[model samples]
Target: MQIPIINRSRHPLPAYQTEHAAGLDVHANLAEPVTLKPLQRALIPTGLFMAIPVGYEMQVRPRSGLAYKHGISIVNSPGTIDADYRGELKVLLVNLSETDFVVQDGERIAQLVVARHETIAWEPAEELSETARGAGGYGSTGMQ
Candidate 1:
């Protein structure tokens, strides 16, 4: 699916690196490097604006390499960008390691995954149906 986007930054538009990649890698748009000390978080801009189609959303997610190698993660993992938002795309990144992490311009900081979503209407109900594992969560199931 083709999307209409406006890129104000010098970096190229976000794209899928592999043939079957589900998300497009988004870059950091900054004039200078931003440093994040341990347990610190910052909102990094992407300088990208998009007219996301209705009934769809853009999900901002962390890169596995960064999370595994540098303990980098998004403060709001899988952040949702609604279709009506017409603003710059920014990523909220956090340093989960013991040291500082520097965010350089044009670096792939997060990914943008376009996903189809549904609009739910609340229905007032007196009672709900039961299930086999009703109200069972948070390690209620045994681990292998």
Candidate 2:
């Protein structure tokens, strides 16, 4: 699956770290460092543009180490990049910890996973079938 991309940043292209890795690591492309105070969020640019295939989309996700270490996370988790978008890729980062965190140029901040998706058309129905868990909302299943 070869997707065309335009990378205008000084940082390297996002790549999978190991064999069978699902996501590629992406970095920040900034002229200067940005600081994020507690509960603050910013849109950090990646300086990357791509033409994703019609059947596929890019999913931006958080780095677990950053979230567990400095309490950093993506504001819109699993941010979706549609196939039609042709602009620079930006990441919405937030500081969930009490202390501030600095974002440096070319710092690995997120991961992008390319996945195949399906487009759905709603079928209007008058009634639906039932199941054992029907109408059971969040946490309705008891722990064993």
Q: What is the Cα-based TM-score of model 1?
A: 0.96
Candidate 2, 72-127: lDDT as tens digits: 99999999999999999999999999999999999999999999999999999998
RMSD of each: 1.5, 1.2
What RMSD value applies to candidate 1? Answer: 1.5
Please, what are the lDDT tens digits per residue for candidate 1 over residues 41-144?
99999999998899999999999999999999999999999999999999999999999999999999998899999999999999889987777889876644
Off by over 4 Å in 1: none
Q: What is the TM-score of each candidate against the true structure?
A: 0.96, 0.97
Per-candidate local distance difference test = 0.94, 0.95
Clash-forming residue pairs, model 2: none
Candidate 1 lowest-lDDT run of ten: 135-144
